[model samples]
Structure formats: C-alpha cells, structure tokens
Target: MTAAERRASGSLAIIFAARMLGLFLVLPVFALEAARYPGGNDAALVGMAMGIYGLTQGILQIPYGLASDRYGRKRVIALGLLVFAAGSFVAAAAPSVWWLVAGRSLQGAGAVSAAVTALLADQTRDVVRTKAMALVGASIGLMFAVSLVAAPMLVEVIGLHGLFTITGLLALGCIAVVFWWTPPAPVQHANVPRGRLADVLAHGPLLRLDVGVFVLHAVQLAMWMAVPALLVQAGLDKDRHWQVYLPTVVASFVAMGAVFALERRGYLRAVFLAAIGIVLLAQLGFLLAARAPSLPVLTALLFFFFCGFNVLEATQPSLVSRLAPPAARGAALGVYNTLQSLGFFAGGAVGGWLAKNVGSAGLFGAAALMMLVWLLAAWHMRAPQTPKTAEEVLADEAEAG
Candidate 1:
C-alpha cells in the first residue's frame, strides 16, 4: 500500500473506532441503568429504547448514501455526525424511557454507514477496497472489545448519563477529524453508471445476505439482553465480567485464525457452517444456563459463543464482498448493513420483551430458534463462485449469503 492509502485507512479506522465506541457504550449497562428511570419497569419500552436506533438506521441508509453520491461524501458525513452528537446529548439527558427511545431514534437518523462505505469505495482502488473494508470491520471489532472493557469502568465513574455526555462530545470531536484528516474528495465521473436502488432491492443473493445479517445481529443483541444479568446472577460482579470476556475475546481471535486459514485453503463453506453450528450450540448453552444458572457452565459456554461469533464476524463480510457484482457492490453492502442495523434493534426489543414476559430462558430459546432458522436458510445456499475482482466477489457473496 502507498503512504496515502495507509494514512487514509488509519484515519478512517480511528474515526470509526471512536464512533462505534460512542454508539455501543450503552449496551452493556443500559438495562440496569434504565430500570431506575420512570417506565423502565416495562420491558417492551426498554427494548424500544435499545432498538430504536436500528429502526431509523435501516430506514434511512439508502437515502443517505444516495444523497452523498449526489451531493458529496464529506459534507453528508459531517451532517450525520452532527446529528448523532445531538442525539447523544438528548439521550444523556433523558428522564424517561420514552425520551430515551426518542434519543435512540434520533441517533439512528444519522445513517451515514452506507455513505462511509461509498466514500471508501470512491477513495480506494478496487484491488485494495476489500482491505479498506476489513479495516473498517477491524475498527468495529476493536471498538466492541474496548467498549466491553471500558463500559463498566465508565459507568462506575460517570454513570450512564455522563457516558452519554462524553459520547456526544466525542462525536462532536469527530467532525473536526472529518474535515482535517480524511483524504481529498474523489473526482466524479459523468459516464460511470451508479448502482440502481431498485436493482439492489431486487437481487436474490443480496436479499439472502440481508436476512443473514439481520439474524446475526438480532441474535447478538438478544443474547446480551440476558447474558449480563445471568452473569450477575452467577455471582460475577459487573466489573469482573471481564474475567469471562477478555479470555473469550482472545480465544475467539485465535479461533478466527483458523477461519482465515480455511478460506485461504478453499474451505469457506465448511468453515462458515462450522461457525454457525458453534453459534447454535452457544444458544443452546444459554438456554441451559438460564435453566440451571451455573457460573462455571455459563463461562465455559460463552467461550464457545465468542469463538463462533468472531469467526462469523471475520468471514461474513469477506463472503459478502466475494458475492457482490462490481456494478452493484455498494448498494448491496448498503442493504446488508441496513439489515444488520435492523437486527440490532429487533434483537434487543424482542429479547427484552421475552425476558420480561417469558423469563430469561425464553429469551435464549428465541435466540436459539433464530439461529436454527438461519442455519436452515444457509443449508441450501451454494458457496458462491469467487469473483475475479474483490468488488464483484463482495457483491456476489453478499447476494449469495
């Protein structure tokens, strides 16, 4: 890679890292904190607060990306960050679950993920685009790890309200980075046909990928809804949750190496199915833990869960990139991302509702069901041919998955 590409990737990675940190900081602690506020006792309302961001994000991603293509990437990104910061402030000050829901909804309204992907596409060449997207993915993975470590400490010091305040300020700071640090704008081509919205919606492979992403994120959020509480019930303190998390994270990272190895050795399909099977087992473990409530068992179970999750996380986008055709890659990715956002929201809401009404066991049962459904859906999916170009591969894989 050239110096310029390296610089661009580094800056964007940091920017994404900060943004995700702000976005995810609340997830680990929100349920317990929100319970202190009015209407927090209602599981459905709390779910709404947690998941509203996904709803708006999914709804607006296409429009935001299209607008960026027409107007310009930087300006749209700046505007989105500003909106996100504003929503953060609102969430920080929210007095009721309804207000929190409103804030989360506002936060999702930013919907700049698609625009950011498009910007990277415009900024980088096709050969290196997959690497750039992987940088973005790595940023997210790092932020998730950091947030899990930092959240309990932050909540201990600043509380959830203060955390929201800090997030808002941090988001505002990202605006400056956008203006000063990112690369110069891409020169627009008049003759290159842009991906069509209708075409993106109509593609069968993209739709399958979209459903897969939705299930992936939905299961993720739903599991967390019960997992933390389960940990506490098992006698682990909030601060000490890292004892379980850190090792699992490391092990998962190590496990993901095998996934890459499989891909390099042309066993992508087998690896993918194995990862999903592990996830299925994790869900089953959760169901058992909910029934029995044992710390050692839960801890052991989570190790396997993270292993599966990390593998899937590392490989899914690569597959998506492999699947997508060149002409429609961006649009396909946009749709895939939107579904992911929707899953985040739906998972939280559904999990919270089930936890409240049917007990924690039911929450895991539902998550397990979702995984089973995804596994079934994937059973018929052929391993898509690797496209010659990364962009074509991404588009095709995304469609195929």
Candidate 2:
C-alpha cells in the first residue's frame, strides 16, 4: 500500500474499532447493569432491549447504503454517526429499561457500515484491499478483547450510565476522524451502468458470503456466552478470563501473514476454505474442552478461532467489493452486514436455548455444525478475478456492449 492507503486504512480501522467497542462494551455488562433501572426485573424484557439495537441496525443497513450511493459516502456516514451519538446519549439518560430499549433501537438506526466500508474500498487499490481490510478485522477482534477487560473495570468506576456516555463520546470522536483524517471521497464511477438490488440479490457468490457472515457472527455471539463460563469451569475465575482472551487474540495475528502470502500467490479460495476449517476445528476443540474443562486446551482453541475469524473477516469484504457491480457495492455490503447483525441477534436467543436444554457442549456442537455447512458452501465459490485497471474496466464494458 502507498502512504495514502496506509493512512486511510489506519484511520478507518480506528473508526470501525471505536464503533464496535461501544457496542461490545455493553454486551459484557448490559444485563447486569440494566437490573439497576426501573422495569429491569423481567429478564426477557431486558434481552429485548439489547436485541432491538441489532434489529433496527439490520433493518436500516440497505437503505443507508443505497442513500450513500445517491448522495455521497462521507455525507451519509457523518449523518449516521451523528444519529448514533444521539442514540448513545439517549441511552445514557434513560430512566427505565424501556427507555434503554428505545435508546438502543435509536443507536441501531444509524447503520453506516456499508458506507464506511465502501469508502475504504474506494480509497485502496484492489491488490492491497484485503490487507487493508485485515487491519480493520484485527482492530475489531482487539476491541472485543479490550472490552472484555475494560468493561468490567469501567463499569465499576462509572456505572452503566457512564458507559453509555462513553459510547456516545466514541461515536462523536469518529465523526471528527471522518472529516479530519479519512481520505477524501473517491470519484464515483458515474459512467458505469447503475446497478440494482437484484444485481446483488441474484448473485450466487455474494449469497454464499452473506450466509458465511451470518454463521460466523451467530457463532461468535452465542459461543462467547458459553466460553466465559467454560473458562470458569477450567478453574479460572471470571475476573481473570482476560488472561486467556487477551493473549490468544494477540497471538492469532502471527498466523495472518501466511494468509496474506497465500492470497498473493492466487490461492484465495484455498485460504478461504482453510480458514473455515480452522474455525470448525476450534469449535470441535471447544466441544472437547467443555467436557474436560482445561484452561490450556481452551486457550489454544481460542487462538485457532481468532486466526480463522480474522482471515474470513478480511477476505469476505474484499471479495464483496471485487465481485459486486461498481454501482451496487454499497448495497451488496449492506446485505452482508444485515445478515451479520441478524446473526448476532439470533445467536443470543439460539445459544441461550442450546445451553439451557443441552449444555455447553451442545452449543459448541451447533456452532461447529454451522461452520461445516459454511465450509461446504464456500467450497463452490470462485476465486476472485485479478484487480482490473481503468482501461481494462472500460474495455470490458465496451466489449460487452
């Protein structure tokens, strides 16, 4: 990547990380913290409040993405951030659980993922886009780890309201980063034929990716709910689980260099399928670890999970950009993220049910099964075409005409 690409990728990764941190920060503590509010007694209702954010975010993603194409990426993103900040502040000041739900719902309404990712795609050359996206992926994983450690400590100091306030501030901070640091908007390819929702919806490969993301996030959200308890059973205290998570997440990055190497060698399909296999292996490991409850075993399993998780995260989005019509890239990603958000929402409900009726092993078993399914689907996916230059793009269009 050139210096400009590095700067763009770095700044956008931070922006992505900050938004996700705000979301993840609440997950570890929301149920506990919500109990302090009025009407927090009903567990189902409290769960509803948290789920609403994902629901609303899922609902709005495509519209926001389409709007970005019509208007502009930066404008749409800025507006979304403002709305997100407002939602955070509302959540902070809520007097009751229902209010908290309303606030969370508001937070989800500002969905800007499509626009943000589209801009990142626009600024970076395709040859380096996956590496750029890897940075974003790593940041997200890092934030999840940081949240696990920080949320517990931060909640103790400032309590739930303070956490909401911080989330709002983080959203506001992203707004500043957007205008001041992110690369200037790329010139839209207006001469390119406009694309439709059908273009994305009818595409088989994108559909596969959409399913893959859905499974990835659903498993991630559901598995984490059980993983912490497994760590506890392994003789690690709840407070000290970070000792396992932080190191595993950090160590996983060491494997990513190999992913980049293989991708550059034009083995992208091979790498993609292998990453899915690694995650499946991790899930199977979790199944065994759940039975025996060994800290060492669980830690090693986590390393493998993050390794596969980060690779899939980077490659999937890069492929979406490469494969989608130029005019419809944002819409395609919106669909991608919508499934992701839905997976998160569904994972909680499904995971809780599996854990309750079956056990930790059952939950991990289900997740492993899903990964196997995804791997099978991804096996048929075509390797991405090489990056096209402007002349190649125009020439191809002219040839088709």
Q: List lDDT for all candidates, in order.
A: 0.77, 0.86
- Who wins the TM-score comparison? 2
Clashes of each: 17, 0
Task: Give the range where candidate 1 is weakest over 10 consecutive residues by summed lDDT.
Answer: 257-266
Q: Over the stretch 104-213, how does candidate 1's per-residue lDDT look in tens digits?
A: 89888887777676666666654455556666766777677778888888998988889888888878887888789888767667676565667778867667767887
| Per-residue lDDT of candidate 2, residues 221-332 (tens digit) | 7776578778878898766767888888888887788888788778999889999999999999999888889888999999999999888999999999888887898888
What's the true lDDT of residue 167 in model 1?
Answer: 81
Candidate 2 residue 195 Cα shift, in angstroms, is 5.1
Global fold similarity of model 2 (TM-score): 0.90
TM-score of each: 0.89, 0.90
Give me the candidate number with maximum lDDT: 2
